[model samples]
Target chain A: MIELTINNIKVKAEEGMTILEAAKTVGISVPTLCHLKDLNPTGACRICVVEVEGFKNLIPSCAYPVSEGMVVDTNSNRVRRSRKTIVELLVENHPQDCLICVRNKNCELQDLSERYSVREHRFAGESKNHAIDISSASLERDPAKCILCGRCVRICNEVQKVGAIDFVNRGFSSIVTTPYNKGLNVSDCILCGQCIIVCPTAALREKSSLKIVTNTLASKTKYAVVQIAPAVRASLGEEYNMPAGTDVTGKLVSGLRRLGFKKVFDTNFAADLTIMEEATELIHRVQKNENLPLFTSCCPGWVKYAEGKHPEILDNISTCKSPHEMEGAVLKSYYARKMGLKPEDIFVVSIMPCTVKKYESARSELSKDSIPDVDAVITTRELVRLFNMAGVDFTDLPDDEFDNPLGESTGAAAIFGTSGGVMEAALRSAVFLITGKNSDNIEYTEIRGNRDIKESTLKIGDLELNVAVVNGIGNVETMIKKINSGEKKYHFIEVMACPGGCINGGGQPIHQKTENVIKRVKALYEIDRLATSRRSHENEAVKTIYKEYFEEPGSHLAHEILHTEYFDRSR
Target chain B: MNTNVLEKFPQNDRSALIPLLQEIQENYGYLPEEVLQQAADHVGMPLCTVYGVATFYNQFRLIPLGENVIRVCRGTACHVKSSANILFALETALNIKAGQTTRDKLFSLEVVSCIGACSIAPVISVNDEYFGRLAVKDIDKIVKKYSARKVSVSTANENQES
Candidate 1:
């Protein structure tokens, strides 16, 4: 431990802790923009400059280590002046379109400008005026708004291990861009959107589906059908200033209904539907001893990652489309049939807590006869904007249930929001399928939490199933290496591209604190705990859908509608 | 498509990325897009990252150098002597930026630090010939002289000299 005096308050800090972190311990919050938690510090932005007694220069507190008996002034005249100057310089170069910016209120740089009282521009710096990258269907990159903080670059290269973009050129000429500054569509970008979540400005965001969704909703000829993902309910409440982990599913349903949707369904019902087909597929793979390790194909980000970097494992991936895709296919097929509407007449909008779903919904494999299974995908963040645009008072909105049989789901479906959830959900029924009885133990505590990789073996009936859950795409290389070296073996694996699973997906609310992600994960489990039925096989709606349209799980009709194929996109 | 540049290097070694790129540049004179992708596959790194590293350094070029290459010295000595004007004069004469090649592939202009010729401040070298202590007015005549010469690759000139 080291004793330091920050702002005349004597504080004890652990060795190797930065002055910014030490100050944080004593409630002296030093604002920072480029310091990503648990990642290596670059000190790219010098906003957290502090006055150290012995130092002649105002040191960046986030990069400076706290020493014993070190005297520091975080908000001294010199420190405040330097920090304010930094904000002014950044703001001067930045575009003055905050009112129309996607990250106006939630932007870190904007908050800093407000905190430093930067009412007027002091420096007339030139804007880079970089062309915005709207090449990808999922993400948009407006480099004009970038502060050169390196958050998005770091997240893309280091955290996600997808070096789609990097710091190109040198010094004042430096810009974060893809190879040759080509469109992200032609680059190595998996479009997971982890960069969007870490970006401090409006530089990175999802491509707007708002205009299309709104136009489609107002269309009298085309029926606008919407589905809400399980994670959106777990995290969207934070947008309304509600406490994190608060389940706003009912209010979310109410808000969507008020948004003029003809019918609002739950993606969880499809999540349940997914489990039935996936579990059967896994059982068959296990029984046949072909494609021994069936990788879960629920995460489109991971699916795309596998398609690019590890195409060898593509066949091992389950052919089941993601839950929302399943819901769309079912809605377009059976639901449309029952409602006496043609597939072309139904415009499916999925409110997903994912950015890759936008790209996933456009996959040609998921479409039939040029009609996409899902028409437009709006993120959880965009849905908040949509509600605000429509003047829906979300807080005061009465709790309302989701529409019809498609909205009903099981407890297993609710847990699909967090890491290790899909595996656990699949196991609850896989055990029943193999043993003709439900497993008394529902929660596989060994594979839970935010660990990058969690693997466990369980005895189900006479078979010992080896399963693994991968939380983030960055940690996947370890699994890939182990599997290739024949050192580790598993019967099944569940992977979510973003850490902590869909609750912390790239399309969710812009939350920087890790606690908020934990809260979201816990909220999903709470929903599962309070649910009446805990197994996917027990979902009456799923059973009804199978009886009404598809004959059964893994049937010919189920394969045609619910399952899809992958392609080798390796560069 | 010849890849003898990587024959001696160990396969699947990411540490060899720079050495591999240097070898490719030595052979091809400029990094080709297809070869860089092959290098990425060999080194187990992403193609974009390889492109990033290739571009981060000033030594590597994605396109071939022109037949007439001009290097304007912007070192500590030359910069004080107003080499900026010389570079701007050259850009105007050549119709290209300092780091870009001409649209006709006849002239390429680049700024260099020093070429052991600081004795002559504000110096520029065009195709292995140096012009020292030159004013901005001298650029048009030098450009005309290079344009009248026969079309020859800069690599062929270097090869013949070596």
Candidate 2:
């Protein structure tokens, strides 16, 4: 540990810690824009500039390393002027439509402008007039609103490892785009929406399906059914001023119920079903020698990426549709039959921590009874808007459970929100199926963290099954490259496009720190461990669905409703 | 590089033109398609369109290239500084155009999109060992080094055969 004085306060910090980090440790607030923890600090935005005793110029505290006996002034006149200048310059070309912007209240730029009292820009330069690109099914990119902090580029390339977008052109005319300025829809973009989540401005946003959802809710002729994802429980509270990781599951269900939906369900129920199908499929594949090294198909972003970039490996991907999409299909088919209603009369809505599900729901192949599986898809943030629209006090609502058989889920289902949750859930069922016995060991702690890449092996019956989990696309690239080169071997692989799984998904309430993301992820795991049923097969609702409707696991009817196909996409 | 030659070439043929151009460039060090008419006959296209595609994109080579490919990144970030100097050095060294190869087939130069290392500006990757923070003075030393290494390898192979 090294001792230092920050803003006249003496502090002890770890050696090699940046002055900004030290300041943060001592509760000395320093403003920053382009500084995200666990990500490379580029010092592109000079807002965090602070005066050190020895340095002539105000140095960026974010990138400047703290030395022994360092004296720092966080809010001196020089520091203030520099910080204000940076904020003013950022606001100069920035779109002044803060009132109507999607990120109006939640914008960091807006907060900084208010903090620095930057009412008007002195150097209002000519703003770049570029058209918004909304061609992608999952995201919209407005180059005009881009501050060029390159957060999206860093998230997409450095964090996710999907180099789909790069700084194209030069200087004032420069823009972030894929090769040849091709539309993101046409490029090799896996619709993860991490870029949108990290973006400080409204330059990047999820493709809004709010209109479709609102239309369905407003329609009297059709009955709309909604399912909230597990990770959503830990995050939905953030939109309502509740702290991050607050399990607002019951309140979320109640809010959805108040929105006039015919039935409020949990995707955890389908996530339970996914485990059953996926685990059974994995065992079957191990026995059959047909597409060894089965890949989990839960993340739509990973699935699209596999289809677009690695079409040769399509056979390796599990045929199972994501839990949300599976629930939609099941609702349209089984639930519609039970209600004695036509599939068209029922509108299935899925609230997910993903933007790719927007694209997944609209796929031509996902339709079962001549109607699309999921009629509409909305993010957790969009759900907050719906709650507000209904005039429901999210905090005041009594905790309520989801309705009936479709609402039943296990702890395993709940954990599926986090990064390694899917792999761990699969292991629970896979171990049982292989041994034909319920083992006391349920938690596969090997794959249970927020690491970008995690690997483990478990002994089941006579075979030692090797498994690996990858959270981000960039990590997926390294794993895939190794797999392609025959450098690493694994029987089963779980790839979640968003880091820390669906719990920290792009559509989840945006929290900036890895520690906060891990906290939310841990809350998900804790919820899972404390729940009664820890395995998907143990869920009575899932068991009932299989026994009453589908007859058995991997049955023809089950396959038809729960599974889908993949297509090779051009790069 | 000549628009008139490309205009005279047929537009419909794609497959035959690529290989034909490759062969022509291999033999004469440039796509002298006037020496080879079989590609036009095989593809059932007039000669003009074939040359048009070859000259249209930066990927294709209508003229003879140097033996080594010296790709300088003219990407937005790289172009900001020192890149012009690097380009000027290459032009002076080879006495050839940006797209053209040396008469001795010693070097070929072209520009590319970003190489994904923005932190290290003014970079050039030769067969992908990105050299960053380059200076104009470093160009001659680097070029001479590659040339010397190539000569030594060829000599070693000759001695091994003997």
lDDT (0 to 1) per candidate? 0.90, 0.81
lDDT of 2 by residue, A1-571 (tens): 8888987899898888899999998788898888887777899878899999978888988998888888889999888878888888878888889988988888888888888899776995798888898988888989888887888888876777666776765567677766545578876678889988888889988888888888888998999999988888887877777766788888888888888898999899999999999999998998886786899999999999888778999999999999998898888888888879888988999999888888888898999656998888889877777777779999999988899879999999998888888999999898887887887888888898767789998888788888999977778768877687886567899998887788778887765666667767877977987898888889999988888899977899999889999998833
TM-score of chain B of each: 0.90, 0.68
lDDT of 1 by residue, B1-162 (tens): 446777767788989999899989988988998998889878887777788789889998899998889999999899899999999988887778988898878888888999779889889999899999889999899998898764455567878999
What TM-score do all the candidates reach, one by one?
Answer: 0.96, 0.78
lDDT of 2 by residue, B66-142 (tens): 56778787777878866878878877876876776666566777776777666676777665567788888888877
* 10 residues in a row with least lDDT, candidate 2 chain B: B45-54
Task: State the lDDT of candidate 1 residue by residue for A343-396, as single tens digits.
Answer: 999999999889999999999999989999999999999998899999999999
Model 1: how many Å of interface RMSD?
1.3
Task: Name the fnat for model 2.
Answer: 0.00
Instruction: List, in order, the clash count of every candidate structure.
Output: 0, 20
Kindly report which residue stretches of model 2 are placed more than 4 angstroms away from their true locations once superposed: A485-489, B1-162
Docking quality class, candidate 1:
medium
